[model samples]
Target: MASASTDVDFNKIVKQDQTLCAICHFSWVQKDARCLPCKDKVHIFCSDCLRQLAHNDESHAEGILFCPVCKMAHRWTEEGVASFPRLDLFNSNNDDDDDGNRLRMRSRTFVDAPPNHTRSYVEEIIVSVLRNLHNQEIQMIQKINETAANHMKKVREQRHKLLEEVLMFYDEKESELIDIIREFAAFEKFSKKVGETNKKVTKMKIRLNNKANSCFHRNIEFIKDSSLADFSIGLNKKEEEFKVSKELCRLPTGGRVCNTSFFNDTLYLLTEKFGGSLFFYKLLRYQMKTGIIESLHEWNNSIKIEYKLAVSVNIYLLTVGEIRVQRVTETEDDDGKFSCTFSTFYDIMRRKNDTTSFVHIIGYEKGIVLCCQDLDNIFTFKKIKDPVKQKWKISLNLPLLKIVDMRINSSQLFALFTENLHYIFDLNSGKILNKLKTSTGSPREVLGITKYRFCTKILFQSGCCLIGNDFVRLIDKTEDGVSSWSYKKIFDLYHTIEYGKCSEGIIAFLILDKWINTVYLKYIKC
Candidate 1:
């Protein structure tokens, strides 16, 4: 009978290719439901379906569950696993060697009689004990189920209290924020008249947060009077955690400033000369400590209609229709003589559009590396040769197009796109490491971004500061070691930001006061 039943079940599985669950009555593609060893073929759709049956079978309240359809005890676990992971299978006292004194796991279906005992007498004694043991199991499971229900009820009540506490926390934080805002508004209004008399805000030396770059130990707090404020994300909301914004100096140019770069503590600003000037453009190097023009030179004939400027250590590389490296000796004072010489450094031409491109330079091992952005791709050129007649050759290429901003470290490149995306590329392997969209939050430590349509980047001591129309996001590239690195954002927001540059942790932005239609150079520490 068993053989005939097994054959019929096999044929049904082979021909129909599915089985209907005995518990749920659902068709499944598995060869057969996990069933007990029985002549009658009973199907259990899946492990979950059988588990539901075991949990709800009140008849087994204090005993082991049996098959619902066949009422036969069998292995319910899935194939290949020895036991369920949640079960505690350890035994302090083992019963592997039996001397007819105690019945064990196998004694449920078959008993082993000792040689000294009569078989019939042994069988009668074992059957009587088995009935009593089975009743004990029923009582144990009933207590277990009752304890579980009572504990779960207590946990649910506590969880409801926890939810209420969380909501209260959020409400308290919101109220405190409103109070701070009111306090700042009143203070600023009171100081309005005194600020117009003799206003002078001295720029302070900005210190870099040389701490490790991980979000594990940060306490995030937002504080902005205007926009989605700057979070002084640090170990604590300490006074040193946040930066002070002060007036640095009014820009030398009243017309406008463009293509700005900062290296060391010096500021390099490109200003166009208008209204009867000898040159079309003038590049000024201003010292931050003295607020005086260190050097001013005519840079008209060397650039095209459009150009980009980058300062690396002491070398200044400019690009537009051509690439020029500003002579390092330009730092020396001429007394009265003016000598601002730039040798044409644009030699390699990979494409026609490469002539007019955005350029950035960084000091590599011995020479300098020139990073250029064409219409289709980004090409990096290494200055392989020495001092005499320096030449730039193509070193590597990355097929990342529409890069609005590019910031380079020793081993990685942070490339930003106008489409609200940013990519980090491993320069050593020329492979993309990570890609992320500019957003305010994420699953991991969400480094923030303010992806305006027009955004630019300026490198700081340990990171790159991304500047937009009103928001600034700092990308910290602090490597845990020389071989590895991580990203962090010290984000802030402002108003009417036109151009920006950073050195160490000091940032200077040319902000236009829309109320008065005037521009001011402001400095802030990070």
Candidate 2:
């Protein structure tokens, strides 16, 4: 009576215990081939099924086959999964209250899934071996919570410091304005007689001219902390180097470097391809910190480089020299570091206007596309999408006059000049917000605006009458106040300025010394 029967129902037990493929109907007899990437011992279906899934996907052109089950789930090669922990069939070390998926099996108990009544079960040994991973996940989640708490604490502290900075900034500017107002008031009190008032004004003017003469124009190198001062010209060549990615960008042998632009810490080098387009042949990204040069994009021959090119966040590169194409669209997902992973392209459909001039494509910058027909008085303001039409792209218009020398500031503002009148356009809507006449004479539109200086709240406007001259203008406004960007400071560079770009705390300029026939690269940190 104590001895158990030796002959049992072997076929019945085999049918009950054998693992079956989720895809293939075959009962897998081998204990191996569990998907290693998955925490639970997910049975790997036959390779034929996996192969079929990969080829059937029409969009998998990049050859990066994704897991069929879920986008978040990943699968490991079955052949290489041999080193993973083996199945433990009879482990008693399992929680009884566990009710999670078997892939992350916390118990050896078999549970039936609904619908087809399929049983999902795996040995407890799998969980025991993968217990370290579960523990690590718990630790990571705790660390993330702690980091978020710390970030919130720091943000509160930063808010106070930022308020102080803004207050101090207004204090200095307001004080200067008050002094100027008092000076004008004193002019009225000087004398009622015309001769006496003219004599006093001449003396005041002479004194002001003398004060300006005393501060002689000085150009010197700044070794450190040159944020709002003269640009500290140099590169950290010891730590960083520059190289180009030849795979994506093609640069022919002995190709002459034509132009350069720097924005968002990435330097764009425009080079002319031999036996190809004489204008912009290729666009390359020079990541100075890493000293790597990769192709930004190989533009079609249609984009001819112009004296001025515009860069903005709305479009990758609108300065597609004179956008000849009636349809304009762009995105910057391919831009390194500054690119948003989500691609945003807009449709810039242009209606033929016989009264307008040629389509002047400033140049491509970020993702924003801005187009305006000169004589139409209808400025096209396009964005990524329009829910109104349930389409991926949208084309809209903004009412604006003939505006030129359009340049982007650090924020969503475009500075444009029409004669002596300066206008700030709302970036997204492209509406001309305000206009102020410049006292610094007409800003040299040929040179355009120098963008923002690194991290500082300063903008440089090219003001020299001659080409290849560097002029600095620090423009600022608080809140919604209407203020003119007066002539503040004119910092000049000796070398002829070829091209300049500024973004993300770095300002770069490509300069050429005609006398020496030498080209130089200058960059300043904010």
Tens digits of per-residue lDDT, candidate 2, 207-289, equal 33222322222122223334622322221222111111211222233445655544555555556654454444555555555
For lDDT, the strongest prediction is 1
What TM-score should be assigned to candidate 2? Answer: 0.33
Q: How do the residues 241-271 of candidate 1 rate in per-residue lDDT, one tens digit apiece?
A: 2233332455554434556665555567666
- The TM-score of candidate 1 is 0.40
Native-referenced Cα lDDT, model 2:
0.38
Question: Where does model 2 exceed 4 Å of error?
Answer: 1-261, 273-280, 296-315, 318-366, 375-404, 428-431, 438-469, 475-506, 513-526
What stretches of model 1 exceed 4 Å from their correct place? 1-237, 245-247, 276-279, 299-304, 323-328, 331-338, 349-368, 373-401, 410-421, 427-431, 435-465, 474-510, 513-526
